[model samples]
Target: MSEGAATAATVATAAGTAPLRERNGGQILVEQLRIQGVKRVFLVPGESYLPCIDALHDHQDAIQPIVCRQESGAGYMAEAHGKLTGEPGICFVTRGPGATNASIAVHTAYQDSTPMILFVGQVGNDFAEREAFQEIDYRRMFGQMAKWVAQIDRTERIPEFIARAFAVATSGRPGPVVLALPEDTLWGKASVPDMPRYQRARSAPAPAALDALQTLLAGARRPFLLVGGSGWTAAALRDLETFAERFDLPVGVAWRRLECFDNHHANYAGHVGWGMDDALRARIRDADLLIAVGTRMGEATTEGYTLVQSPLPRQTLVHVYPDAGELGRVFRAELPIAADVVSFAAAAAALRPAAEPAWRGLARAAHAGFLAHQQARPAPGPLNLDRAACVVRERLPRDACLTVGAGNYALFPHTYYRFQGPGTSLAPTVGSMGYGLPAAISAKLEYPQRTVVCYAGDGCFQMNLQELGVAMQYRLGIVLLVFNNGMWGTIRAHQEREFPGRTIALEFDNPDFAALVRAYRGHGEVVQSDAEFGPALERALAFAQEHSLPALIEMRYEADGIAPGQTLSGIRAAALAQRAPAAVP
Candidate 1:
């Protein structure tokens, strides 16, 4: 026996008649996860890792295993968990097809800067190079998509690999890590000590950097504060709030990062991203200084990198990020501070602002623009998304978590919904559809006390609707609002603009969404008109709470209601006018 095994045996023997327990790599892996304070794991069951599932059975009381219908849904749930808890979300899947299916969530984690760990069961070591059943090189497949990828060939190394996985996943510029486990190795016996919980190294801005930032802020006439990315704690958000208020800085959240700041704050500017308000774009364009905190200022956040010029932005840019490597990678920064969000915010809060600048008028104007843009416009159809957003904002609890997948339907919540605080919004920055339902499930599981709502489009919801079974099985009380326009609204809107009445493969004869939910033994409702939404939402919320199961509400709208302040017909007309032949003269 190995020395580690002998020592474990001796300890067991000393406990008077307690038999020495022989453990496999699977058992060790689960135990290590428990030691790392992982309370849950999302997974899709497979025979490739039967031993892991069996081991999970023993640790069910300590670590709840949520079985999802599809690997993609499981991965999305894990990603959402990571976003909410600031730890590596855990997901397990089988080899080949399962791993490929779960890659979407891995990509989302990479782009969104959320920490996650994906474990894939592999073929036996003997079959690895033979291209045997369900065999694939995970390292090559996930090389560009993940921060780190490795395969464990020995049972004894499980502890070391798992500990490193957690550390790497949560470290600077957090992202997903992929670990492959061979079936035979998982079944092998080994004694290994579990590592303690992992902690990320925090970085603080240098005194010089802070002084430079203060000087810049003191001189700026119109400074804009942009906040985004993960690695945020409640304390960090509180510090950011105080920092924004102290200087009356206009704060704008990056793409889908509204939860980073309180939207109702007096200094709040509108979010900067796709479908952003024109007024907010003007503010970004006219700003004399832009202080970006924790955000990478990626393509989406920068409106295809057009809002701020590349290499040298038109405005002076002060960029703060946890990773030094990310600093000045895209847009050149006049002052770069390599500090974590919380640390930088705390340091910035210490600086005394030069007597309230005469430029406070610009900040107030930005806030006014944000408020004006949030006011919903009248819809021509009975099913008005504007009204729905308002009703949800008024009805849902202030701390309720709202999740959305990609679609024009998401614009309503993005524009009108008020997130009272951090950790309240979970939307994919990568524009992945079908993310909302799984994320909502994970959010509800993480915070059962808070209400959870998922806003999905007809096409978006169907992408992972199979996960409803997971919700029903786990008894998660999440409310789903499906905007049913019988078409891929965003795609159709684009086609109308570009093709000018040439539409193809955009419409769908969808399943009865409400009936589909009911088939899963959950409550379902159909709201066809504006007046029906409030009562339907109340019923859905009450049903979710009473049954402890997900409730679905299918909201029907006319095809012309493509998006806020835009319609399919209007787009087609404008496109035709642009393409029409001019008179000879």
Candidate 2:
């Protein structure tokens, strides 16, 4: 037979068979993962999961394993991978301490609505419930942290549990799931058929709902669009942009969800969360119609549920979410639409908007306010954060991924940098510190061509600083930007506000981060001024690109620059004035 005919015959023959084969439970689990298109698994090897690790020996070409320095770092990388790919990022860890360490990322994935699966190795089935070595009840431990948690003791049901884990993780309001594998069960032999790739179910808005939304939009004077949450595809983002532009609606994202909308878009308003713009907050509070899409309007986004009052909002609220349970769980919406964000956006894009929206000027004003606030003013001290932020904005790639942990220093990039599109900014909305560096590593590993920058505070950087080894080992280029202010800036700022100079345990001495990265055989530099930052960043980026290794640049600043607009001394003065005796009353 000719080459074409021979190829067709081979395909026909292969399709006729089930491709089933006898294998150990561990091998069968690996085969199922391979079938699901998993490219990598982040892990810290332990003895309990040796069989699975051994099974991985034969599939090196199929799935690459990322050996991390710690379980938290590994889990963070996995969570970041999930956020970037919209797939269930896989992570494996041993029981007890390993599981506890990984819980940080599990909670992050849960709160951030990212899809991830954490497979924890458990004690052998023979040691069940006897408080054996490194044994912990995973179901009880991870019940609140994970979307679903279960232990698989039966070798025959490996495929079933793994498939269901993926389904539960990627389904409604995508989040993390946990599966525990007993050592003995993983070593047992089993013959199981692999599951096909899981597909997420997309729910679209009803025609009546769309009509009602249109009616609400047509009559509104000041309408604002709040978009957030995960599970957004590129096409969905495009649809969202189209809907916003067509309706001349001002768009604001919830908390750290700047990735939900292009910050450069004409309709883009400021982020609505902690350290949010006062003008944007006013706009959100005063809007006649508020359309919340995808987001849960969590505490941060809602300003502790003060922006949109609970039970009943001051403005007419239209809430849309993927999970039906979350629609009216908090604030009762005027129109609650339980549909996938992407599907709803696609359907909303098809609606015809009013030829002359009454609130066109309101959208323009909102966008103008956002643009105005992005221009950072001169800050105190020699190392001006405003200038540094401006340098990053002007020098870095528009689509470069910027990750940040919780700190007052984050306000600079949060206000100054403009995210060009979705999935470019990875920040922890739940205020998880030390997420930036690990997330940057994962971003680079997933998209090697894209530039990944981690903006971390002195305290935040040290939280997962050991992950630099992981980057070096894998040859992934990522830039670490450390903002060294010589204290816990956010806590200090709050202390200054509340106690008026009673700063106690907030201050601490930090190591030379530049020297720290250099100790790891990575490029390092110190930038003392605004002019020094550009050259240092350029050198770091060039070094990372040329060597395919991690780079760190430490920018030194004073403690008085607690935040962009407020100084520590100013806060103290205000507090003291508030406490001063009122004419011996």
Candidate 3:
């Protein structure tokens, strides 16, 4: 597969003006990716995609493939890449086992609205109905999670499929797409012209819709802005901030979307997700006008549809999104504007407020509540996870990237740290547990100079801990802080709340994570108290930066201290008291 062959073959095909050359499906697919500006690919090698790997060997100038330790890790790295870049993070895996392993990140991408593409190497076409080894119908398996799923049969259609994959993955309500490549099809050859690169189709808000939004705001006593989901450009975020500043509207970021807005902004409110501050939640519930942009207002953000009622919210709702289908799917909107973030934000910035905002005090109070929420008190443990989060925020540069997987521990960083934009945060809104480590690795790989830190719980870290080997292999100097409490904190809190002391499979013992990091040929440390943390962190960062290797600090904490200002035993005691006959009433 040489460019010279493509150029020298001047015999144009009968159907087109451009010359066509005999190229295998793998070569064509890779070339098409090159034309689409794919700089890197994440994958775990398999025999099914051997031809593609062979093509990669010759076309090294086009794309750099990062080999991962497991299919899941590869998929996660790709998902993180997508979150950071707003492009389709590409992943390649083999048939059944590989595809199944990679499905976790695919689900995260789907729920988080990140653009990504997963390429699975399928069985030969000859074995279509025989249920061959390592074979599964991806179209059926990934149909629900992915925006589109299909298999490439004819080699000639490779370019067409690739182009459409990019377009669909980046279009409205951007999500993951799956494309399966049959082994036989990839090995076959065809003389065909390449399809041009795909561009994201943008939709702007109609003028009347903008007018209705301004009218709604003008009439309201209180209005709020909630931003999240995906397909957001930096310019869009700037314009959104401009709109908020002009209207003096309170802005709250959706779950795991700290990147959506600058936390330091005066109009910024507290995090609007699970375990949100009571003050902010009440403010949202009481707002007269709610302008929700980009976010789908999922269960986490809406507190199980209680904050803003489904079907018909009590507050007048102005929903803005790239896709129209999601506008009325759950909550009916007074004004539904189907426009991409870029366009909607631009329009919003340009619109003149009908009057001076009546909700200035409300916005100021919301920002105050957000600031107060960041202040952490002592927990029932030696290690102050919240203080450690503050340490990372203070010591690291404002541009440093922070990654966290889902756990009770994640709440600390979500609460304490201030995010600048997309470059600073990598978290899974769908609450996937093993996302942090790989996401940190991906961030470091993408931005080698930026400081990268990962926060994970004992249970969450163990889920994809083996990926440490991949980080060590790549010499990615990422610092990891493992909050070890010997239990899955989130479930323990819930279990204590519902059943008191009946803890079952949720409790588990963990290995020495510091030793595990050492075994992986990276720097390691143990910090159990507040005094040991700062010094240990400094050492870890110094080691990682100087040695160009990963570093881990195992910060041990008490199991009873489940969350900030919350204890498991206290919860159990409260539950038991509630269960014991309600005062004979």
Give the TM-score comparing model 1 with the true structure, all chains together: 0.96
Name the regions of candidate 3 deviating beyond 4 angstroms: 1-18
Report the error of model 2 at residue 305, Å. Answer: 0.9
- Give Cα-based local distance difference scores for all models: 0.90, 0.89, 0.89
lDDT for each residue of candidate 3 in 1-585, tens digit (9 for 90 to 100): 345445545546444566677889899999988889898899999999888888888778868888898888899999999999998999999999999999999999999989999999999999987989988999889989999999999888999999999999999999999999999989988777899989889999999998888888888898899998887777888999899989988999998889889898998997897878788988899988999999999999998998989989999999998989998999999999999888899999997786777776877888988888787668776787778878877898888899999988988888889998877999999899899999999999899998999999988888889899888888899999998888778988898899888888887878989998999889899999888999999999998898879999998987787777778889999999989975655
User: Any idea what lDDT model 3 has?
Assistant: 0.89
Error of 3 at 288 (Å): 0.3
- Total backbone clashes of candidate 2, pairs 3 or more residues apart or in separate chains: 0
Q: What is the lDDT of residue 97 in candidate 2?
A: 97
Q: Each candidate's root-mean-square deviation in Å?
A: 2.3, 4.8, 2.5
Question: What TM-score, over all chains together, does every model reach?
Answer: 0.96, 0.96, 0.97
Top candidate when judged by lDDT against the true structure: 1
Q: What lDDT tens digits, residue by residue, belong to model 1 across residues 1-585?
A: 677788877886787746455689899889889989899999998988888889988998899999899999999999999999999999999999999999999999999999999999999998879999989999999999999999999998888999999989988889999999999889999765567877788899999999899899889988999999988888888888888888888999999998998888888888888888898998888899999999999898998898988878999999999899999889899999999898998888777786887577676778888888777787778888888898999899889999999999998998899886666999999999999999999999999988999999999999999999988998988999999999888999898899988999988798899999998889899998988999999999999999999999999888797778888898999999999999898
Model 3 error, position 192 (Å): 0.9
